[model samples]
Structure formats: C-alpha cells, structure tokens
Target: MKYVIKTQECGYLFKNGILKKILFAGKYRILSMSGWELKITEMTGKVDTKGLPTELLMEQPDFVSRVVRVQIPDDCIGFHLVNGVYKQVIMEGEALYWNVFEKNEIRLVNVTGTEMTEAQVPAMYRHLIPSRLYKRLSVGEGETGLLYIDGRFEKQLSSGTYFYWIYAHEVSMKLYSLKVQQLEISGQEILTSDKVGVRLNILCSYRITRPLELVQKTDNVANLLYTRIQLLAREYIGGFRLDELLAQKEEIGRFLMKQIQGVQEEYCVEILNTGIKDIILPGEIRDIMNTVLVAEKKAQANVIMRREEVASTRSLLNTAKLMEENKVLYRLKELEYLERICDRVGSISLNGAGSVLEQLAALALPKG
Candidate 1:
C-alpha cells in the first residue's frame, strides 16, 4: 500500500491497533500483511488531540493529550483563572494555547454582555483597555464642572453624573468654587505720578456669576483678577501725585473700578467690593511729612497766643479810658483790684482803715 500527504498537514500512521511512527508530508510505502490496519490523521495549521476522536484523548494521561489551542473571540475577553482564582486579563485579540489537565478548565466569556468598567479592570491590563469606555466625571450639589473636549470649551455642566466615551477625542473637566471667596492683593509697590513710591494693599471679595465663562475664558480666574487689580491700581496711581493719593486712598480705588470697571465681566467674575487695606509710604517721605505737620501746628499755636495778648491789651486801654472819664468808674476799678489783693493775703495789718473789709478793698489803690 502507498499513501500521499499534503505539505500543510502531518500524518500519523498506526497498524494492527498499535501506535506507529509519525509521518511528515510525502509518500509512504507499506507491505501487505495479514490482519493489517492503517489509520491516518491530518494535522492542519496546528496539531492537537482536541481535533482527534474522543477515544484518543480519554482519561489515560500517558496516551491522552489535553493540550488545546484556543483563540479568544474577537468580541469577547478571556479572564484567565487558575485554581478558581483570577490570574490575569486576556485581551480580545490575544490567542493562547492552554493545556487543561487535572482540575483546570479554560473558557472564554463575552465582555460586551457584562456590566463592567475599565476602572474595575486591573491596572496591569490598562494598555489593552479602551479609553472612553467608562465615565470619569460626577458633579454634586452646589458644584459645577466645565467640560472640554479636544482642548476646546464645549459647555457648562450642572450638578449630576457626567460620562464621556473616549474614542478619538480627549476629555477633561475643571471644577470651580461657587461659594464666596476673598482674595487678598497683599502689599504691592505702586508708584504715584509724582515719582513717589508707595506700597498699597487691597482686599477683594467676590462670587462667580457665570461658572462657564469663569472657567473657559481664562486659565486661572484668580490670577487674572490679581493681574487686573495690579494694573488698574498702577494706572490710577500714575495719574495722581503722592499727597492726593495718600489722602484719597479709597477714592483711588473707585477710579480703579471706573477705568476697568467691567473688565471682570469678560471672564464672568463678579466683584463684590474692592477696598484699599493699607497704604505704606517710604520712611524718608513719612518723616518729611511728619516734620511739616508738626511745624504747621507750632505756627498755629504762636498765632493764637499773639491774638490773645493783643485782645488783653485792648481791654486794658478801654478800662483806662473809662476811669479817666468818671470818678465812680475809677472807684469801682480800685475796689475790684482790692478784692483781688484780699484774696491773696491770708491775714493783713492795716495802718489806717475804717474796717477790715475797707482795708482789704483799698490795698490795690495807689498811696495818693
């Protein structure tokens, strides 16, 4: 007898119900014998006992083969379990050859039919997982998230769970603080128009008017507001001299609002109230101003003293005129003088006087 086999397949020959040598692709010759049997098996693409008859792969481990080739379904994934424990995740396109023996069994399950997320999958299997398959965003009450796709602003999202299917587009979200916020523009050196350098500190309190614009219009709203404050303050200060700006610190802040009043509107930021916290002048300037103030006060004191002295002299002149015109007026003036003298003397010894009261009254008069 003669047999021929194709190059793509291997042939195994058995005679008289006993195993024989394996045959590769070619022609084989056998001599005719009594009670002779020839069994041929074809090994395509890969040779395995799985394609062979069931009797060939029975419980006999010595002669039986449990090695099999399995290719995970294109639409399914393989969760490799060993000893009933999760081993590793097998990608959809991955094909593996598993030899099941004793207690192990290899199987494939449909991934599309199951409710699972990429996050649930182990990190070691991330590279094989799809990006946009799971939702990554969720917003709660009193909060908002800004959605951006492919680095472009899409829209605003309110409180709720948000999902994105990451296919070809990149997804990202930015959360904003909606509660009232206080920003401090701490000590910033600003120069006045007259070339006097001063440090100005300001405080600004605000809340978000439009959450979408607040996030999309600027990279950092707080930073932008800070920059705006500095620029506006410098511009306002540059237009005024030192003395005026120092005197009207609050008023200068008003001008800051007037020049760029609605500037924050561009970014959807609302300005509640902006006020100057403090103004600091240079040491030399402060000392010089203090000296000038003290000198002006001293000058005022001197003027007041001279005015009082002149009024006292004029009153004395008027009193003298009255005395010269009337004897009664002169006597009254003398009596007034005597009373003052009596108040100063605790006890008195008068040489000629009608009474102690008379002595005391006459003490202030001239001897003549």
Candidate 2:
C-alpha cells in the first residue's frame, strides 16, 4: 500500500509494529504488511521532540530536538522533579533532555552545591518552590536582629543581611534598636505636696545597654520601662509643693535622674537623661499665682519709693542745718534765691531810676 505524505509532515516507517526509520517532507510508499505513522511538527524548530518519549529519544540524541532540554550554566544548577517528587539534581554546566510524552515533569533550580542531598530537596514540585524553600531577614542599621527557629531563640545578628532555608522548622526574626532613643511621656496629671493638681510632660533619653536581656527577659520592655518612669516621676513630683517645684525645676530633673537609675538595670536600658519638659498648672492655680506675683511686685515698688522719699527729706534737713550754722552761707543762699526769681521775670522795672543799679546790687545781696 502507498500513503501520500505532505511536505509539513514527518513519516515514521514501522515494520511488524516496530519503528524503523523517519521520513521527512516527501511522498513515501509502504509495503502492505508494514505500517506508517505520520506526525506534523514545526520544521523551524530544533525539531520538537516534546511528543516523543525521552527514554527512547535519548538513545538517538543526534536526531532528537530541543523541545524540553534544560541547560544549566556554570553558575547555576538544574533540578528534575518527577511526578511531583525530586528525582535528580544536575550539577553546573550540564544539559538534560526531556519530553512531555511521559507523565513526568522537569524544572530548573539554581543553587550552589556540587551535589544536592535528597533530604535538602523540597518535596513539592519546582513551580511552588521559591516561596517555600527559603526565607530572608534584613537587619537594618542601628538594629540587632534575633533569629528564632521553631519559636526558640538562636542567635543575634547586628545590622546585616541574612538568609535561611525553611524545610521543617519555622523561622522568624525580632529586631531591637541599639541606638540612643527618646521617649516622651506627656500629659500626666499628678498631685503635689500642697494638694495642687499639676500636669507634667516628661522626656527620657536612653539606649539599650543589654540587648539580650531587653529582648529575652521581658516581653514588652518599652511598655515596662515607660510604666516605671511614669511611676517614678509621679512619686518624685508628689514630694514637692508647687512653689518649690516652680522655684527650682533643676531639682526635679536631678530627682528624676536619680529615680530612673534603678529602672536602667531592671529593664536593661541605659538612662542617659530624664527631665520634666513642662509643668502646666490648673487654670485657677495659674491665675492665683499670677495675682500673687503682681501683688508682690507692687509691694516691692512701694518700698523702693518710700526709701527714696525718706532719703531726700533727710538730705534737705541736713542742708538746712548747715546753712543756719554759717551766716555767709545763708546770705549766699538769699542771693541764690534772688537769682532764681530774676530768671523767671524776663523784664524787671526799677522804681528809683537814678539809683536803679546800686539798689539792684544791694537787693541781690544786702550788706554781705
């Protein structure tokens, strides 16, 4: 029997149900007892051997096409997972041939190992690997990262890049700052020794002295530290009256620093500074203080004025006593008063015209 072969079709010659040779792009005549299998494939390709069985096609590598061939370069590796299970790992710079005809799959995995272990291979297929195979942890600057595996602390890393593989145990990281940090505890209202309610704003600057103790010993170190600071500030403020606190705020700062010293060791934090940022009195109290300040200033002004007036009066009395003790000085004073009177009168008229000059001189200082 004769079969008509198209130019785009490849013919497989079989005798007694066994493949013998391949036919390409031509008409072919077959014997009546033999059979012919024709398949259409893209000629432009390396002749897609995807539909062909790899076990049988690999035997004739020369005639096979690059349908499912995976090439692993020198810097990479290839993994082949068969039937959803890891079967083989190809090392650097290797080529693997495969086809889709079999019920198997092959994927390429890039890793760094001369040979991969069976235990290290993921049980899943290649497509779902990257998300399940490994994990990454970034320890930023000024932060210390703590690595934990299966909820157990492993090691602490400082400001760097880290990578880990996840197969059986769960992996995670906790970061704590190693730099100086500031916390502002604001809007706290406490009672003073004078039973006056005053609002306080506090600022604290500190750093992590012991990272391991801060992270492992306490679950919420920041909250605990804040609580202690707040309590200490209140206790210290309660010991002083409003007037005393207002007089010397530096004293409150000193007391606050003293109180926070013990908190540093307890929470593993170095208390660099602690101070009261602002002291806000109640409206009524602020008004009362203002009134008191104004009244005290007025009393001081009145005292200064009375002192100046008394000093002036005593000086005048002493000057009068000196003038009475000396007659010539008294006569000089009479002439001084006459000069003052003449300065006020711009034009003075003398009654005695002929004796005006002599009379004026005599009236100015008589017989002195």
Best by lDDT: 2
Clashes of 2: 0
TM-score of each: 0.47, 0.60
lDDT of 2 by residue, 1-368 (tens): 55666654455555665556655666666665545554445433233544655455545543455235555765444666555656565654534433333323445544443223345455443334454455667898988987887788888888876556564457888888889988888999999999999999888888987887777688777677678879987877788888898887888888888888776887898888888899999999989989999999999999999999999999999989999999778778877866887898786666755444456666667574
Candidate 1, residue 319: Cα displacement in angstroms equals: 4.1
Instruction: Estimate, for each residue in 1-368, the C-alpha lDDT of model 1 and write its tens digit.
Output: 78777654445455665545445568877654744444454443223543445345343343334334356776655665556555555655533332333233345655443223445454354444444343457787777888787788777778876555454457788887677788888889977888899888888777777987565467677888888888777766778898898789888777666554487678686777787888888999999999999999999999999999999999999988988999888888777776887798897778763854576657756888
Global local distance difference test of model 2: 0.69
Root-mean-square deviation (CA) per prediction: 14.9, 10.2
Count of backbone clashes, every candidate in sequence: 1, 0
